[model samples]
Target: MGRLDKLPPYLFSAIDQAKAAALAKGVDVVDLGIGDPDRPTPASLVEVMAAAVADPAFHRYPAQRGTPRLRQAIAAWLKRRHHTVVDPNTQVLVLIGSKEGLGHLPTTCVEEGDNVLVPDLGYPVYGQATLLAGGEPRVFSLAAERGFLPDFAELEKLADEKTRMIFLNYPNNPTGAVADEEFWKRMIAFTTKHNIRLVNDAAYLEVVPGGEAALSLLQVASPSKDRVIELHSLSKMFNMTGWRIAFAVGHPELVGDLGRVKESMDSGVFNAVQETATYALGEAFEGLLAEVMDVYPKRRQVINAALAKMGVEVFPSPATFYVWAKVPTEESSIEFCGRALEEIGTVITPGLGFGTGGDGWFRISLTASDESIAEGARRLEGWK
Candidate 1:
């Protein structure tokens, strides 16, 4: 009777139910289910926001695309970080958060019958948006055999006349896989050749640890006939998830279309939030990012070590704050998560929640405190 009825059940809620059941039984739950960072926003940024909120100018409606100061800051950060140049006036549109933009972008480019290429184990919003926009979602498999990267050959084979968009994420979610410059070049060439609009969800772009940084999809070339857009969020980088601030940047026409959607759907991100985000996107904020990143390496090591001691295998993720591990037993992903809650009092995201390609895998967020992560791993070791 309704389009919302077609959507699959939310995975996080199901996991939460199991976690609640464990808590009801008086179990001490070490939750690693969601990717929300546990750290507080840096003191300096908090101070800036507190001061900005007192200004009457910030109380007014913000520019639909974003404040000019925020857009300029984003542009400067992109150029400094990725060697990519973009016009603040035409190529940038701020989002309430990347999720808000990601959910609405499909409606701008996709139609009732178009086919959108999506990663099999990608963020669920990609596929859900496609369906909500009355478009078809064709899953592109990401397998361990290929280091969890997409197979261009397979994607080409799967693409057809109806295909209109391709969604990619690097420093990917749930899997922690990353793409290199050469990979970006190939993806650009492939999308250009096929004339499909390419959208890169770069939410975790700045989260890479002890590895080469992820490249912006815009690094390749300017838009000639084909289009490319990227969505970047401050949530993971600045521990500003609750602030709901981000931006989409790329081809001018595509960015404008996305802006039009924003204009029609809502007023815009609050001016006060944009003022603080301007400070967060500045070059000086890298010091805060460095401090936040320092916490992840040790946390990752403790979790990986615990998994190894339990006779389970998992490669420490070079990027992102998640640890993706193959399930040691043959249990289904949901069943494995349920059993972890029942046995070890630990809560993790079942891989199948990402997509069927993740059937025998599970994801753990490094968003918990180091002590909590170590204890959760220790409990799993006892279960093993």
Candidate 2:
């Protein structure tokens, strides 16, 4: 509690507290405000974790840099998924979760007062990570007109000598916007020119439509090979959120630096959990990924169709399971979310919770059961 008021009420926490209050009052809130995957982890992976627990070695401290097998698995998975070969010993490092890896990178890379380019309407963690790392988070707005992509011309001008890192998320969370190959090349050039590092969050990589995806900073084919690192999560795609299995892959030096910070932080995640992730990686979902991805669009349609009936025009969200909707009339997002939950028993995240650029919009998650999604939609019909 020592001068730690540097943060805002991150979107999910406020909604979570409200959900708890409603549940306490015997109201059945469907709890769609958070982006957590509601799907269960595949049973096959659980069996491997259970087996690993029986090994005495797993009972000992796991390696700080993860086990060789786990690292190999991560490299293998990256090669399989992205068609990019990452050296397991150098270009890969296992994280407690991608969040922790991301949270610590600023500390490892940025010195005090160094600027980090952050997205205005992207994941809250991108900014928080910069702040916690004692770096300046120079937010570049993701205007709706630009399809939520940052104006690099403006951002490029902002990146003077002090900027050290730039965060990019494709299949972006909350906004669900994807960038093209040109976007990757533009950023790679900018980072290369400025001698800054770029961190790409590929958390939603496997959830893209028809399995057609965007380019990653790590996949930019730079000869220096020290320009970018991509963070991947096993959360949404594999339903492994609680397992905390994630990794960073790219420049050997960059991954090595993050690995040193990680080594100082903790030994590693549960060896059993790492083993489980290894097994899960083998089951790539292949074309099945697109099939799984189809569910999100259907849920989006359901909630959006209902919102349309209530006269709320939703914006296109191509990747993550989110729908950005302008609150009906001129009601503020916080006020609208409050009234919706109290009167309609439906909950959502306010736009202001994301950042200043998100003030006029609210995000509805499509990651829950379709029935629950439809019910959430039906609740919106009562808004008018």
Candidate 3:
């Protein structure tokens, strides 16, 4: 089968269709499905981009592996935020967005018949990328009983000589599960023993509204020494989702390999966007991030309280702008979420849209506006 034929349907498209149907019926819908932030990019960054766009230097084809200044800024941010150090020249590669980097990563290492380990309940890109790279994707369960972490024993059983890489997302999508330092240490040891490449999608790493910063894999394993890489984005950090600027940092060789794949596929991020990102990571970092993150904690509280009133069981975590909860009724996640939209005119994500392992769960995104969150919560409270 062709690579495209091997892939499953894109989940969010189905959700969008349902939402559109509800809207067409003149139902007032409060969409809490997709995780795109409803806020605008920080004004400071926008102003910088406006000026940068007029610079003749940035109007060219742009630097293939990011300009020196942006790579240096990314390295410095890693040191300041995660307390990790990497060589700006060799260990950093700018991406159009973390999603694009992730889509290209499997091509760098996987050959036909090789397999990559992917979470059963994860961002769909992981497995899809593997298929596109002509590699098999082996599923690893992230059970709620185990706090949505993979069991090492289960991993050992699934991996074999052909296993090439493992994809992980902490401060994870859909589940809001953050991996602590101890978990990173164990993962590094396991992957090292198996001689497998390790990749962590750290897009939501800085989205912690709970005050305790999330740990980066680089903090535990030396990317210079280990076969590891972490992809970080400015999308969530600065409300720059549409800007499409992120970077990958890790083993110099791995970073270089991904860069090679990107060279053939795309021309790299717009230089103006990269400059704006550099500014975002520089002096404006703290204040702008604070402004972006300040809203999530209260939004989370609103949804959590409403879910509590409805007697829904939530998988508690303060990491991402997502609330993962069990389906209160006997229905599957699809049925429960469908009923929620039809009966209450509120949209929540079905866990089955993520994977079969997510069948009994549902996800609520805190990315909606305050008024929308309030309305959605009100509707959910009356749902049943």
Candidate 4:
């Protein structure tokens, strides 16, 4: 058998293993674990997709850049919802999903041995992608004291001339933390001084708890415009995770680079899905999507309240479908996760999978309903 010399830690795999073991035993698992939306896609998007499939043309090879109709709709939606302007031809590029878009971005830019600034507890792929690109991954700390956002002091300590890109995600995952507009300005200034390109992932932009706005790197001041590339996914917003559809908007120069890599990578997205996404955007989101975004926050409150009642310490996540709750006592993060799964059949993501900063913390998502949330809470009453 062949084997690799080294591979980075498989953080979520351990959690998945423990969760899987319990599931195999027929435990009644209340799955507030994965961040995936448990809701259905909008009816209008579904209707359009069904209609488009009848054309049969969408079954052929799609343009690697996606159809112009989808491209234009993405651009218009960006302009309308984000108040950010982008050119459809050069500045907008489609992806299998934002995950691939982000994973491959470093390969398009970073040379071997170059450094990439990453949050210690940011999305695991940020570092994973950097590794696959043959780049060094330098993690910046995001302690709770720092509100789970990047701390410049730690970032400065890890900086060097080899650094080429900095991966940023606001309304963060695993922490439910967010950065303000001022934070964006400061980040822009810092990156400018360091000559670092910014890769901002705005996947959770439309999924916030109270609709409080998310900060965009494009909106930052003092950097050469387009020094940043912003990414968006239809997964959370339109309930299209399995659809594998998303786009990147920002600096035409950088966006073009991703397009080039993409052409050599795959043929394109499913034409019907792109067509349906375009239809949804053209109608301005109407009431269909509005109803979908409404479901998570109510679920968020349920998990938040349940955690509180169980003496689990947590705060309301500003955005996204996750709740980062603290498990009391002196249990290690991985152990806490194991016990939770074995005892309650409740599988939560262990924060340690996120990185060093997540040590001793556990994350519970509100993917379940109010009754499920209440039941999970009742089960936790046995936890100690």
Candidate 5:
């Protein structure tokens, strides 16, 4: 089959149709499906962007590998936030968004018939990008019993000479799983031994509200020595989802390879956006990050309590703005989520939308507004 034909149907389209039909019937629809933050970008960052936008210096095409100042700021931010250091000149590459970097990554290494190991329960872009690059995506299970982490034994069995890369995400999407320093150490060894590239989509790395920071793969793996790269986004950290600015930091060759692919694929991110991002990652970072993250903990608590009252088991994690819950009934994830919309006029994402490995769970996004969260919680409690 052609690559397009091989792609699975877009999962959200069905959810959108169901939501639209319910709205047409005048039913109140509380959407908790997608993980887009409802919060506004920090005003300080917006002000920076407004000023940067008017600067004539940024009018032309931007630096393909990112401006030196932005790249340096990213390196400094990594050291300040995660205590991980990398060369801004060699290790950092700017992306239009983390998603854009992720989609282009497979092309940097994979050739036709090569395979990439991907989490069975992960952001769909990982596998889909592999397919588009003419590479086969091999699935590795992330079982609930294992705290949604990949089993090293399974990984050993799946990987072979043709395996080009492995993609991991933490704090994970839908599942809200976080990997620690020890996990990172083992992963680095595994990838090094196999001579395969390791990529972590650390989009939610800064979303922790538990007073302890989440670990980055680069913390344990040397970006200069190990074949590893990490993609971090300003989207979740600073509520800049619409701004589409993020950066990749890791092995110099890997960063450069992705940059080379982008040279032909598209222009770099707007210089104005990069400038704004530079400022966001500068002195104002901690304060703005605190403001962005303060809302998720309370929202998480509200949902946790509601789910508890309903006797639904939530995968416990204080990271990311999502609550992964087990399907209380025997119904599959799709049936459960569908019934939720039909009976309660609330939308929750089915785990099966992620992968078959996610078959019996559902995801509740905490990115909704406070009012919507409270209402959705009330409806969920009442439904039970």
Candidate 6:
């Protein structure tokens, strides 16, 4: 309870509690509050995992960083997907999940009282991790005017000698904004000039449409990998959230440092899980990604059409399955979400949960079934 006092309330957990209460009252809830994918893990990946689990070799503790085979698979995947080459032995380190890796990274790079530049309305883990590392977090607002992208001019103002790191997430959580090559180049240049480490959380990179893949920071940061590290997750891409495995790729030094810190905290990801993930990232991944790309866009369409009929305009994202919408009234996001939950029995995420910069908006996840999403929309339409 001591250090816990320093943490902000977990907004999602609170929403879950409210939803449970509604259920207690016998309300049928269309829960779009969480970002978990509704799809099952592809049969191929599960089959590989099932076979791996029976192997006596996989029963042992995994390497603290990752198995050489797993690291090679990740490196190969990066080469094929983003066209970025990396040294598997030196640059790749596995984690329990992207969330764990992102949160623990600051501990290795930031010293007490150093400045950590974080995006407002971005993932909460960035700021929380900064605080846990005893660093001061300076937030840069992501405005809809700029397509929910971070304002470079504003970020410049927040930079100084004390700045140690910059945290970014593309196809961002809650906002559903994707980054392009130009943006990545600019960010790499900015961090390089400041001599600051850049950390990009790329969990949604593969959760994009068929033709357009999200650009990797690694691709732009290249020879400058010493200054940047990117984290990717199997959770969104493979529908493996519960599996809890991800990897960090970057400068050998940064990856090594993170591995050291993780070693002190936990032994490693389960070997069996790592073996399965290695297969997921290898030859079998592309077709599964294509199937995912096909499914989510239609779901996005269903949700978007419903919101439009309710007069709730939103930006159509090229990646990620979230819709960020402005509140119809002047009510606070919490108040708006409260009304939706109590009157309509639909659990939505209030934008304020992301940050104060997101105050006038709310988030709707496209993770529900087509029928469930449509029903949620119908309820909203019926709201007087």
Residue 358 local lDDT, model 5: 95
Error of 4 at 44 (Å): 1.8
Candidate 2 structure quality by residue, lDDT tens digits, 161-181: 999898888877777778777
lDDT of 6: 0.86
Residue range 313-377, candidate 4, lDDT tens digits: 88555577888878676988888878888777887777788887898788877767767777876
Models 1 onward score TM values of 0.97, 0.93, 0.99, 0.94, 0.98, 0.96
Per-residue lDDT tens digits for candidate 3, residues 80-196, read 988998999999999999999999999999999999999999999999999999999999999999999999999999999999999999989999998988999999999999999
Which 10-residue span in candidate 5 carries the lowest summed lDDT? Answer: 207-216
Relative to the true structure, candidate 1 has a C-alpha RMSD (angstroms) of 1.5
Error of 5 at 304 (Å): 0.8
Which residue pairs collide in model 2, if any?
A: none
Error of 4 at 318 (Å): 3.0
Give me the displacement of residue 9 in model 1, in angstroms.
1.3
User: Least accurate stretch of 10 residues (summed lDDT) in model 2?
Assistant: 1-10
**Any runs in candidate 6 off by more than 4 Å, and if so which?**
1-3, 223-226
Cα lDDT for residue 290, model 1? 86
State the lDDT at 192 in candidate 3: 92
Candidate 5 stretches greater than 4 Å from native: none
Better of 2 and 3 by TM-score: 3
State the C-alpha lDDT per candidate: 0.86, 0.79, 0.93, 0.79, 0.93, 0.86
Tens-place lDDT digits, model 5, residues 1-384: 898877878888999999999999999999999799998998998899899999999999888889999999999989988899899999999998999999999999999999999998989999999999999999999999999999999999999999999999988998999998888899989999999999999999998874467888888888899999999999988888998999999999999999999999888889999999999989988788888899999999999999999999999998899999999999999999999999999999999989999989999999999999999999999995
Task: Give all candidate RMSDs, comma-separated.
Answer: 1.5, 2.2, 0.9, 2.2, 0.9, 1.5
